[model samples]
Target: MKNSRGSLVRPHPLPESASRPVVTPLSPSVVYASDTPDALDAQYEGRVHGYTYSREGHPNADVVAARLDGMEGVAGGVVTGSGMAAVSAVLLGLLKAGDHVIGGNQLYGRSLRMMKEDLPRLDIATSLADPGDVKAVEAAIRPETKLILVEAVSNPTLRVADIDGLAKLAKDRGILLAVDNTFTTPRAFRPFEHGADIVIHSITKLLAGHSDVMLGWVAAKDPALAQRLRVFSVTAGLTASPFDCWLAERGMLTFDLRFERAQATAAALADHLATLPGVKRVIYPMRADHPDHTRAAALLQGQGCNMVSFELKGGREAANAFTRAAEGLSFAPTLGDVGTTLSHPASSSHRALTPEERAALGLSEGFFRVSVGLEEPKALLAIFAEAVAAAVPGA
Candidate 1:
């Protein structure tokens, strides 16, 4: 006979059934039980299929990774705690001291910071180049360069990279090209199909299609490279929680529908903003006036993403007033939500850069980014038009 406390702690296991649940069951256990020491050793040695620790690997993360792999059409992938974790896992996992990295100047600010600030601390060298300019990237590469990193579509600025050109250059130089496809997602672009060695994503964005989860993933065209990244992620303890993974997977079910709705709204908004009184410029990949319009058309197949950025003639004051007057919009620092939101790049995304650096990137005081959402186009257009009038008064 067992004591009450012992009996309570050791609950009876559920009976096995042939029928399976329609939805995948969420497994939140951090540690798993093994039949014996030999079985545990076999699992640890990779001779058997099982999870021992959540930090190394788990069922939820595996399922999500598999789905991402299918979407990217890659050999394999791994999920991490955050987008930055995926970035760090790739950079820190593959490169060692004395190696060099050539990265795009217009990447997400934190990624740029990691290259310029963090990599240097570890004795690794980094150089910045305009990813849209393939010749400039090639010029920046050195004999020791092991990696070339760029975003499929740059943050806030919306500079589209020449992925094919960059991939060819990297391959000829024996360097790996890592493309961050967070902004574009797989629906807009697939890096692997175009010769990229690695593809990264901030799954918190359009892939998840909601702002509920903070998760990211990295996929590799080569199985060996994917294994390397997975090992490094485990060692660094960058694995995502089961709950986050589950939430992200759920969000992915509606990704295509959500993305299509947001993209349509963004396109209409871009055209409307360009004709407004106080608007100075609109930056959208599909716009003919965009710097990378031709390349974006070819790569994205005329399907631009949901992100839209514009500059106001009144700069900071006008931006502040617009946010205050905008009826249905929220002033959020992050992006990819169901509700339309505005973000100030100068104060939010690109604040890490020095004033001079930010000016060079064309992120001025009036610059604002819009994450279009599932909203009625007419209502949003009216709201923005009224706010613009209120902000720049009589312009």
Candidate 2:
């Protein structure tokens, strides 16, 4: 977040009350570049390294990219216009016509759709598998398998994948391991430290907690691979505006503060919602009742993320009713905003997936996604509880 003027007064909104605020120490003139630099010579322009143009490298974008690389502990990083841009750049850079990609079936709908529909158009073959089923991952890999991609914490349903195990598998098969850390961000998980070759994030989500920016970042352990990503990013013109990068950086600085409260809210709401009527199932990764709680505990040692998804007993109609009844809840398909966001899986984020596809991934019509924010845990819960009570009869 080069040139990011983070909140001078970093407000820590508490569940109970507001605390004394601390301000960030950065104020760069974050202006979008007029010239979209294409060539290396033009992008570098005898700068610190070789950044000649705005498209390839601008001081502002490069500064933010460096911050991301440092945060993720990777060799290099590339920033893009959006998370999908980063995904596309990595795929275009790493995969070729005959290359095989073994992907997780339970992914952000756009991600899955990208592999299923977009990759084939480029003549790349993909094998979708249940990431929760480790055996399927091993079984799906072919000799041509060049990449094994999975979300660190999946969208809609917050299922934690065995990243270290998958990274080892990719190492054994000489395939790249790319983990999408959009939900968890670096505050909760560091994929490279866990043996992943590459880590990608939709900064617009959790990292840019304010939901005002549309940016993406990809960090790689291998410098060679990072260079390839840079090449693809420049060629594809997947450049993030400096203003967006600055805004995203502003959000990143407060990530620790925001998530601390959000995580607590998620936990409290998880417990509260489980007892409420029409809430048949709850999926909070850190909860003891969660099937994958042990692994989540092992991986996310201290920092717990704020995403929680649950099944409403009343199904789609209930889901729609609850969402429509939301007064304080921000009814958006996006997540990780400072404002609490409620997403309906059947019609929102996973709408791109067909009924069969969603069912195979265990995404039912009753599924509701919640991104816990700085809102008071009780207030958010009460908002949802009232919605649930209205959606389902009795209590």
Candidate 3:
């Protein structure tokens, strides 16, 4: 290695036979090589073609980023190590000390905690408002407010946000509206179409659709913001691993089919759960009883989310019993798996919140969220029915 410039100087060529196949699956590579000194210099100088380092950029990451951008119809995007990484990159890259951010009260618990606790530590103030109440959200916005953070569909409860309304609110105030569209994958609801300034996704969920990868992405309607995010991602060391990006890209091939099937199952299961005596309430975007039904219908593009939530009359005890009885389904803390899984919010996702805080968000001891999977609907229904009966024999 005897280069004054930053270009990688290989001692010798990679050992290989002269003959090689023309077609091959693209593999994850951390570093690219070139034989010519001038070409290598050009690459190091930012004039030539390939990735010089893994942290800055890679081919696998580029493919995933481009596909995500295409899905959302956004200008550009970047992949990150995790969903929180994506969220943090956008907030830290775009916002600074003294900036004001408006966040939704019904956001994912970790996101809420970050805005409420971490942002204040950095002198970036945040106001939590229910996006469902447009007037309340508008009231909370201040002159210094620069961003509105919300979820396309809230976690655990499946409360769909009025993205179009929030988009208008952000536009009128000249602020950025960032929606975490993890619940409704871009195929189900393109946030850009509804005028969202930024669209974020926890690709670990439905996009991956198999629970094998951990990755996230942020796409921006504004190219400048996307560029900033890319730089921030690299410097912050939050860029997704090349292998994860490659795996997620492969998952995207069947995402449309998986999401369609899963959501249909969710809708059917929601209706069935509503009929169960043990379930006090069922929440799904397609249900008429859901408060956000009309709004979700308008925004969901006729495909409901791959989640169904319900409240059991007997509280946490019954939830535990049901999970024990549900032999075929996984009792996992996470969601968006190909195999259906159940999670208890009171004990898992929203466990950090106080009882009052949980209650305010309509989360109680008996509340459970079911992530519908790509399985036979009848088989899933039978397993759930058996579990409910075992949990509440009389009811």
Candidate 4:
């Protein structure tokens, strides 16, 4: 018999059985053991289907990647620690120094910062263009341009990119087009279907649908690109934790249902908010007044995205008052929660941009973005009505 210390260190393995688990088991072990060194080598060399280390690859990550691959209709995919990690994997893994990249002007603030600030430090060149204008993107491309990055539907402002036109341009130019689909998710739009080479997602957002886990993924239509991203993700140590992956998968189980309800509420809210007093403008892709409404209608499915952005006439002071007066709504800097939440763009998402840059994008101090939740529509409308009244005062 073994001593107490030895027994405590090594617990008995569960007995093998024919029964299978309905949910994917969380395998958090950092390392795995094999029968022989040769077996381990085979696993590491990809000669067999197994995991040797969590950083290189793990069961939970693989399962989630496969699910994303199916959803995005890609050849393969890799999940990363965060949305920015996935973005970095693509930028760093695929491109090298001296290569040029064309990015949309309306990309997520952090992503735009990477293109504008970070890539230049690494000797890579970047140009910003209006993704809504395909000709403008093509004009920005140069001989060394290797990639064109755009969001399917832009952040905060809700500008829709012309993916098909951009994809064709990239193909004609022999460059790759990467679309960030976090705002639209696969339910609203699948970039691969529109001839995009790569699809990226901040799984922390709508896909997970609960705002609980921080995760992201990149899916490539080409197997080689997917492999490159996976290799770099491991080398850079951007792999996600097993527990976060498990929670993300659990949240995704109700993604379709949750997305539908939230988007429906968003459409109603957008219409109602536009009619409210002191409302300067409302930004939603489904709305006819949106600049990209036609393109959005062509690209998006169902009711479009679950996000709504509105500006108040009273500016910053009004925004503060509205947040204070809104009883049921929470003032969250982030989005995609079970309950309706509000985000102030100038303070949170686009805080890095200078006043001139934000003004060019029409992101004013009173501009607010809403992530519609599963709350009753009537209650939400009432909350907004009262909040707008408090903010505008006599409006």
Best by lDDT: 1
Per-candidate clashes come to 0, 11, 0, 0
Off by over 4 Å in 4: 1-8
RMSD of each: 1.5, 8.9, 3.7, 1.6
Candidate 2 weakest ten by summed lDDT: 24-33
Error of 3 at 168 (Å): 1.2
The C-alpha TM-scores of every prediction are 0.97, 0.88, 0.92, 0.97
TM-score of predicted structure 4: 0.97
- Cα lDDT, all candidates: 0.92, 0.82, 0.87, 0.90
User: Please, what's the RMSD in Å of model 3?
Assistant: 3.7
What lDDT score goes with residue 395 in model 2? 45
Per-residue lDDT of candidate 2, residues 243-330 (tens digit): 8877877778787888889888888888888998788899989888887788889988855589888888877888778878878788
Query: Which ranking of candidates, highest lDDT first?
Result: 1, 4, 3, 2
Candidate 2: where are CA atoms >4 Å away? 1-51
Model 3 over residues 206-226: C-alpha lDDT tens digits? 898789899999978888888
The lDDT, on a scale of 0 to 1, for candidate 3 is 0.87
In candidate 2, position 279 carries an lDDT of: 87
Model 1: per-residue Cα lDDT over 1-395, one tens digit each: 65775468656666799999877789999988888999999998889999998998899999899999999997569999999999998899999999999999998989989998999999999999999999999999899999999999999899999999999999999999999999899989999999999999988877776788999999888889989999999999999989989988998889899989999999999999999989989999999999999999999998899999999889889988999999879899878888898999889888988889999999999899898989999999999999898889988
Q: How accurate is candidate 2 locally (lDDT)?
A: 0.82
